[model samples]
Target chain A: MENMHLDQHISKQFNTDLEKLRTAVLEMGGLVEGQLADAVKAIETGSMRLAEKVQETEDEVNQYEVNIDAQCTEVLARRQPAASDLRLVLIVSKAIRDLERVGDESSKIARMAIELSDEETDPDGFVELRHMSSNVQKMLNAALDAFARFDVPAALKVMREDKHVDREYKSAIREMVTMMMEDPRSISRVLNVIWSLRALERIGDHARNIAEHVIYLVRGTDVRHISIKEIEKQLDQDQ
Target chain B: MENMHLDQHISKQFNTDLEKLRTAVLEMGGLVEGQLADAVKAIETGSMRLAEKVQETEDEVNQYEVNIDAQCTEVLARRQPAASDLRLVLIVSKAIRDLERVGDESSKIARMAIELSDEETDPDGFVELRHMSSNVQKMLNAALDAFARFDVPAALKVMREDKHVDREYKSAIREMVTMMMEDPRSISRVLNVIWSLRALERIGDHARNIAEHVIYLVRGTDVRHISIKEIEKQLDQDQ
Candidate 1:
């Protein structure tokens, strides 16, 4: 009876550790989301202050990743967690990496915003940038939510949305090329806008990667390097 | 005595698994290097055959990542390695992610080569592309070599080289912008070259990332999100 009670106590402690790790990851995700939103708004409003704020927040995001990574290592070392618990720790490790990269893309966008704040803005590229930004922001939010809930269906939706985001990115690049060709003098400025658009597109890719991690976490399937259609078919077959 | 022999046998098996994982990663690194070389050559010589070969190799590269990742997980689950052994598994996990990304960048460069094969060649951008390509390729090779030997000094050198690559990338972009402004008609073709240059620059960044992983593995310190100077100081203090 005493052994059984000790086992229960240990199990409860382990659950608390896992719960805390999850909360830390979500907190990090929230920080990255806010940084991305500020970056986009800075670009739209040409607010150097907001862009600088994003830069400051970047350090915080990095610290979160480092801290979360340590927690994961501690859990793995102490618990030697098996099966689902092992998967959770591994998934958190990979997801934080994606989140850190999303933070990087956000910082790149913010830098572009700062560069364009002094230069004459090109309205054409911003139309595409703004559109793409909104799409990626939603995708990232949904991806984080899916992770929080282990919602495979929501993750699948985010993966499907990535394809559309890729198409939007290609069309936006084409439009930028045409704009640069029409006004050669605007080449440098338009190039910066193109970079901002590129950053946004990459953010979408990172979000898709997070969504894939979520699917892997919940379904115990590796969904990377496969098409959304294939992933969906596999999930359907599993059912 | 029977139990002692059993322990020895299990330890030997674990060593074999770790050895196999390391060799697989090196093989994957070698494949990615070939793809990058082929992609660069295809751009320089306009060889659609070589570009297609690179595309074919990408699937193989992706498969290597999946295989290595599974091996890492198996080791972690079975061995529950602590201290240095645990760090080795984690480093391999993170390094493979960087390797997979390098493969993606190589594939992107190959795609740019295919696009440029049809268009009229622009010699100016190719000069910078070739220069950046050679530098990144060397950095990647050095990084992998460092990982194979667990050589921290070699890894540090690769990290230092990354800064030069970034500077070169910036200057190349500046030059490309000038060429586009001078010959607006060449904008489309030159843009493809710019993309290839960007891909090469990103490859250098990934190489640096791999080098950082190597440093972390050897030193048991997280060297990410820190400047090279800071990393050096930290290592010096430890010594």
Candidate 2:
């Protein structure tokens, strides 16, 4: 009976540890989301101050990754968690990396914002940029929500959203290429916009990766490098 | 005495597992290197067949990542490795991700090669592409060598080389932009070259990431998001 009591206590403590880790990851996700939003705003509004703020927040975002990684290592070493607990740890670890990369893409967008602010604002790609940013932001938010709720269906939706984002990205690039050819003088300035749009597209990719991690966590299936159609088929069969 | 023998057998098995994991990562690394080289060759020589071959190998590279990831997870769950062993598993998990991304970048370059082959071959940016690809490839090779040997100094050197690659990438982009401005008709073709150069530069970044993982595995330090000078300072202090 004493041993049983001890085991219960240890297991409860382990659960608390995992919960804390999940909370930390969510906090990191929130921070990255804000950075991305600020970056897009900086570009749209030509706010140097906002862009600089986004750049300055990069170190803080990186620190979160380092801290969470250490916490994960501690939990793995101390608890040796298995099954779902193990999956949770692995998911958190991989998700934080994707979040950190989103932070990086945000920083790149912020840098582009700074460069664009230096030049005469060319409205060639702003519409595309704004449209794509909104879509990506929604995708990221939905991905995090799915992660929090362990919603496999929501994650699958995010994956589908990624394909939409890719199409949007290609169309934007095509439009920009035509614009650059039409007006050679706008080439340099439009290039900055192109880069920013590229960064936003990459952020969407990271969000899709996060969604994939969530599906893997819930289903214990490796969904990476697989088609969304195939993933959907597998999930439906599992259900 | 019987328990001690069992302990010895388990420890031996754990060691063997770690060895196998390391070997697998190297194999994956080697495959990615081949893919990258072929992609570069396809671009330089305008070989559509080589580019197609590179695309076909991408699935193989992704499969390697999945297999190695599963092996790492299995080792962690079964052995519950602590200290250095735990670090090894973590490093392997992360390094394979970088490797898989490198493969993705290679595929992107190969696609560009196919596109350029269809267009009139403009010799504007191929020189920079070749130079940057070779540098990035060397960086990746050195990083993998460092990982295989656990050589911190070699890893540090790879990180430094990454900075050099970045400089080359920037100069290449500047040159391409100038060429595009001078010959607006060449804008579309030059853009493809620019994208390939960007992919190579990103590959350098991933190589630097792999080197950072190697350093973390050996020194038990988190060297990410830190300046190279800072990393060197920390290493000197440790020594």
Candidate 2 wrongly placed segments (more than 4 Å): A1-10, B1-10
Per candidate, the number of residue pairs that clash is 0, 0
Q: Can you give the TM-score per candidate against the true fold?
A: 0.95, 0.95
Q: For model 2, what is the C-alpha lDDT against the true structure?
A: 0.90
Candidate 2 CAPRI classification by DockQ:
medium
lDDT of 1 by residue, B70-129 (tens): 888889999998766788889898889999999898889899889888885446688899
lDDT accuracy of residue B180 in candidate 2: 95
Give the alpha carbon lDDT tens digit for every residue of B124-191 in model 2.
Answer: 88889988898999999999998888888889999999989999999999999999999999999999
RMSD of 2: 4.7
DockQ score of the complex predicted as candidate 1: 0.75
True contacts kept of each: 0.72, 0.69
Interface RMSD, every prediction, one decimal place:
0.8, 0.5
